[model samples]
Target chain A: MIPATLNVYVGLSALLFAVGLLGVLLRRNTLVIYMCLELMLVASTLAFVAFSRFNGSMDGNVFVFFILTVAAAEVAAGLAIIVALFRKRLTVQVDQLDGLKH
Target chain B: MFPAIFTFLVLFTAVCAAGVIVCRNTVNAAMCLLLCLVGVAGLFVCLEAYLLAFLLLLVYAGAVVTLFLFIVMLIDVRGGAPRARNPLATVAGIIAAALVVGGLASFWVRGHLAAPAASATPALGASLKAYAYPLFTAYLLPVQVLGFLLLVAMIGVVVLSRKPDPGPKP
Candidate 1:
């Protein structure tokens, strides 16, 4: 049973990672890309929870809590940066924002 | 019992994740992400980490993802409607998906996974004691720093989202 649960958990996480990767590659909108990034983070959180359970330690859960904290901070700051960038450029298309490209 | 529940949760998460990627509208994608987070929390439950699972739903799905949706909706920018389908990327996604499924099959076949065992400490308070020692002693500084970082992020968001100065300085 634990084996099956872990398999499902890992499988789900992999699916999530793959979906996020696909979104990153296929989507040009920055906001959608940001959502994809969040999906990827959630996938990692799932993996952490699963492993922590597999080990029978609370450490994984605690680590996931920290990950959540970091994710919150990251999204807040990232969205702010994105907002500022949008203000300056009026567009959120990743391909259009080539100013950073050398 | 656990396997059935876990499989259901995994399927739920997989579908939501697929929705997030395949949806045409940004709002729908954000909603899909919310569903994905909830499914992750459900997986947490199967792992016997009930506290972490609920917290996952509350902190992530309730707060962070909603905030993300708000920002996505507020923004005026738009693009990437996925006009004509690209067969190449679609094929690549399918192959990647299949490989992942194969990895799961291999893991299941190994039969080396361990079940939840009896622990010396079972209660949440005991668990907290175990958690807090390391968190307060070894991880104290990083945790405090993260709090400050969150504070700064909040203030930065408020500042950035504020209206521009109305009058020019003399």
Candidate 2:
């Protein structure tokens, strides 16, 4: 049996979210930024499950089902876009691909 | 046994996520993400979300990370170029991130719901029947729409990955 409280789980969620946000802000690699976005999504799911379990409802769990499905599709599409970008520009670094900065 | 496991999972997931940010090599970052997903699955199990936990492992750890690795290999972008320190952007990004962290910390300090007593909390069984009923009932339309969305995504990926025409820049 687990002896932790809800606050503990929420704190973990907050911490992960902060880390993901920091990565998105500071990291220049598009791939790393994308991975950090996924981290944020997963952290949100963890909080959802914790709330669902602690509140004794299935709503949170069901939401995670949808999130997982959507995230998979998002990853597929996003990666395809990244690959296409790489082929067109030959660089995955964000700063080097600045064609629109007039 | 479980709390100890939960603590370990939390630490493992956080460390791996941070590694993704700090690692210069794209492949190394991808590997960190894989480990992070595994740790998240463990955390899901701790929350008793048995099915979601498995799906996370199967979909995220299995498919998504594999796709990332494949892309990294194909592009052969081993390590990111060393960043030139831009003072303005660095300051702005750091300030924005700090604001977000501060907001979340404040939310935890004051706004989070008080956890009810464990014994008083109702038991939400992590069973398939409990999940399937709602997905098939209340969420049926969303499910159908998402199915359509997935098909659209598949078509889009196919279109995007095709070779561009052999013409001049328009």
Candidate 3:
């Protein structure tokens, strides 16, 4: 059984990142957009782990540990903000939330 | 056998991620995210990062995706408003995404990264002790800082979600 090359892993990571970026660009729903952003983060972490694996380093793994920690916190805070915005405005749609445009 | 498994996992993850984008309902998107994360964990296992494989599953699938689902239900947003046939933003976004993907593909084809063979690489991520050593030593500072960041985030969320004071409630 041959191990997949590092390039394959990195390419998969890039593809996922691009998909996430596209979601962020095309979607107007704030929650979905945020999910896409998290997707991008996960994709980067995959690259980090893959690179670390190929290079025989522990740094990337440790970095991913930190990223996981931060992600948990970020999710909490972000959802809270989204909820608050919804409560105040009765909408989570980004286009409608543009009160500063006037 | 190994490449087959890797290819399957990659396809699973990519499809699920795209499912997140294409699914109109928020709940479905959240579920797609969960599945995508699970596939990523499978890929992590392939990379021999056993710890991160489980960590990604535990933190991301167990906690993060659940939170997303809860919020989706609480807010009760059904789906996006089917907008008019304005193709401009959609077309522009597709172009941008394609450009980014094309650039990365070209770089991958042209880039000459001298990666060491996997057999020669140390599987540091396969064990718990290897992880603990760094968390307590050279990377100790970042660990401490992340703890503080978590605390700050908790406090900020509490404040942000607090019920606004209604003046002179009867």
Q: Pick the candidate with the highest TM-score.
A: 3
Calculate DockQ per candidate and list them: 0.51, 0.62, 0.70
Residues B29-84 of candidate 2 have per-residue lDDT tens digits of 89998999899898777777788889999999999999988888888574455668
Select the stronger candidate by DockQ from 2 and 3. Answer: 3
> What local lDDT does model 2 show for residue B6?
77
Q: Candidate 3: where are CA atoms >4 Å away?
A: A1-3, B79-81, B85-88, B168-170
How far residue B15's Cα lies from its native spot in candidate 2, in Å, is 1.5
Question: What tens-digit string does per-residue lDDT give for candidate 1 at A1-102?
Answer: 234445556666766886887788778788888888888888888877776666666666678778889888888888888888888788888767789785
Q: What share of the true interface contacts does each candidate keep?
A: 0.57, 0.62, 0.78
lDDT of 3 at B166: 80
Clashing pairs counted in every model: 0, 0, 0
User: How much is the lDDT of residue B47 in candidate 1?
Assistant: 64
lDDT tens digits, residue span B46-152, model 1: 66677777778888888888887788877875643434545886787678667766766776577454545424334332244666786888789878988998899
lDDT by residue (tens digit), candidate 3, B63-111? 9999998899899574346556448887888789779878887968796
What lDDT, from 0 to 1, does candidate 2 have?
0.85
Candidate 3 lDDT (Cα, 0 to 1): 0.88
Clashing pairs in 3: none
Estimate candidate 1's RMSD in Å: 3.9
lDDT of each: 0.75, 0.85, 0.88
Residue pairs with colliding backbones in model 1 are none
Total clashing pairs in model 2: 0
Best by lDDT: 3
Residue B54's lDDT in candidate 1: 79
